[model samples]
Target: MNASLPCVLFVDDEERILRSLRMLFRGRCEILTTTSGSEAAEWVRRRPVHVVVSDQRMPGMTGVEVLREVAAQSPATMRILLTGYADMDAVTASVNDGEIWRFIEKPWVARYLVDTVEHAARVAQHDFALAVARLAVPPPPVVGNAPIAARIAVLDNEGSLAAQVRDVLPAAVRVEHAFDLESTLELLADHDVAVVIARLSSTDGDVADALKQLKRLRPATLAIVVSSLRDSRLLIGLINEGQVFRFLLQPAPRELLRRGLAAALERHAHLRAQSDLLQRHAVDAPRQEPIATTTGRLLRAWRRLREAATLRSA
Candidate 1:
């Protein structure tokens, strides 16, 4: 292996799978294959690994558990969960606990897998460099007890999600509600929303596509999707394309919703404190397919927002 190639670690119980992955990523990355999830976690702790791709159904520690440990040990390392089955619990845990960068299904297209790993490696390298620089900087002084007032948005056709957010969050946090794409874009344009709790419509892809565009325009603003939709593929798409912070089932439990909101708020604060950290949440570019009517209108609205901002500045 060349010493200069970006390092990618693959953890799967099957030796054949490891061998296949090793062959796939041979020339592009410095491949490290291990069947033991524990060993993979240890490797992340001991060295500078650019990325870790783990199988979900491993023996000792599940992929979610391994990625969670990796997150704690080395947050700069990009994490991906590659599994044959779409285990719902694992998928949810991957979002809430592991916070993986992408979820790739098994029997993946060879080119797509390679592209994902390469992108992750490049991102990890930048993140690791940024982490090192932060260590060298003097820490900021701790502020007083006053909580920073921030705005939250709820993009749901119905008022339920907004009401839920209002009930769960403190009164100090202003909650903005938007029922349509135009309104949502206007709200985002006017306010620096720290977190957005958006609904995923079961009937259309418009909501998901809008969320992805929002992330691309504003990486610092965290998004939590609350939906009744149980499609694992859609959730995975949100993870990779939107970098969605969390996915909550409809009628989310109060405590879980509260915890998710708190986490999103804390993450937003961190991003605000260090803008460069936003790159860690970078999402993949939108798909090239033709846009739907709703999403096309959304694009126009977003363009108008940009024009207004530019005019104000000028």
Candidate 2:
């Protein structure tokens, strides 16, 4: 195995599945395969593993539980969950507890799996660099004035969950509710929303789609998903595609919601400050030439006619 290559660990209860993954990722990365979730966790604890991909339905310890332990032990390592079943409870737990970066369904395409792992490795590298940079920089001075309150947008199909979110957030933070995706986009366009709480319905993919668009428009805005549906695939889509900041199960505790919101606001401030700093130091380019004035345009037109007549006569 190449010591320079990124180390990737694969965990599953089935031998054949592990064999297949080993073969698939053999040359691409330093692949470590294990059939026990507990063993996988132990390996991560001892090794400088860059990524861990585990099966969800392992015996003794489920994938979520194992990944959660891994997360606590190695927060910088990227975690991926692979599952045959779309158990919503387990999926939500994996996201909320394990903080997995991506979820891959069982019987995944070979190319897709390879691509996802490569992408995860790159992200892990970037995050590690950023962590080092943060440690090197001195903390900015604290402002004396009261901090600006973040504006939050809550989107729910029936408008009930929105009210619940609003109740938990502080009174100083402005909270806006939208019943559907279209309204949510409009609200985002009109306001500089800092956080989004989306309560998803089982039948509709609108909320997920809306969140994707929201990320494109306001990449710094933090997104929190609230859902009762136990579809692992849907949750995976939200995690991998939407890049949600947090996932909360339905009927969430008020305290939990409040804490999540507070953390999200802090993250938002950090991201916004970084963006502003980049803009401030960005180099200015030469401006485009101004458009022609009315008198200049007339002069140019007269010159063209005289030049045309001289050429025609010659």
Candidate 3:
């Protein structure tokens, strides 16, 4: 593909591996390499690198630690972990804690390595594109009884949901709550909340149906489905297919629930407010139906919208 390749920074303590990668991918991308993690971090701090591929077996800090730092600083930059099976725990931690997009074996083939890097570049570019989308289309408005609040419901056969709601959200929220999906949706339909905290039950209820209906009814509403099941397949399905905002494990501590819900709602409010702004901007935006192209049709749409926004701002 003739896509604009992303700037890549490859970090490893080994000079041979660095040289080999340089030989293979020198012309493929605007490549940057560092033999030390400290240098790599500094390079990242100084410039806007799109993607970082790092070896896990560094001398001082593991790949996970390095990427964690990267995630905190350059969140838009994609991360990848390269390692030769020294520790499975580190690899897993790298994937989870660092949010590393991909994990590759150390003795990778030149062709495979190239493909992996290319794929990561695509992902990094997508992340950047999504950031632009967020800029172009403002998030939805934040409307609620509480100035800063969350709409949380804990599904219980009894009124136990009240406890969950209280435990999760602060006093800033006016708890419009319920025990099941239907009641929750009724409250949600009437109220303006950034988040819906719900629980799953299989003894006599279909939790998936509840989640599906909520998403169908309110496309912009963010659902945080909680389940105590051994497997979170249903929650994952809702998130993947139904476009539910996020999911949480059931039996999570009340404090954890509070923090997670607060965060989810904060994001929800922010996205809504931004979306409303974008919608308002679109009123006089030099409108276009849609573009037909292979490369950057999506990005072009965003660029146009952002252009409109720029015009309005100016």
Comparing 2 and 3 by lDDT, which wins?
2
The RMSD of every model to the true structure, in order and in angstroms, is 2.8, 13.4, 11.6
- The numbered model that scores best in TM-score is 1
lDDT, model 1, position 291? 38
* Model 1, TM vs. native: 0.90
Best by lDDT: 1
RMSD of 1: 2.8
lDDT of 2 by residue, 1-314 (tens): 77667888888999999899989988889888998888888998897777889899988999889889888887667888988876778777776777677778888989978988876766665555565687979557434211366788888778777788778766778888887655666666556678899887763554665565445445677789887776666666667666677888788788888878887787677666665321111111112111122245433433443354345336
- Please give the distance, in angstroms, between residue 34's alpha carbon in candidate 2 and its true position after superposition: 2.5
Q: Which portions of model 3 show Cα errors greater than 4 Å?
A: 1-4, 8-46, 51-68, 78-146, 202-220, 232-248, 276-314
Question: How many clashes in each candidate?
Answer: 0, 1, 10
Q: Write the per-residue lDDT of candidate 3 for residues 223-259, one digit (tens) a residue.
A: 6655565343343234323444444455656765666
Residue 289 miss distance in model 1 (angstroms): 6.6
TM-score list, all predictions: 0.90, 0.75, 0.50
Clashes of 2: 1
Error of 2 at 206 (Å): 2.9
RMSD of 3: 11.6
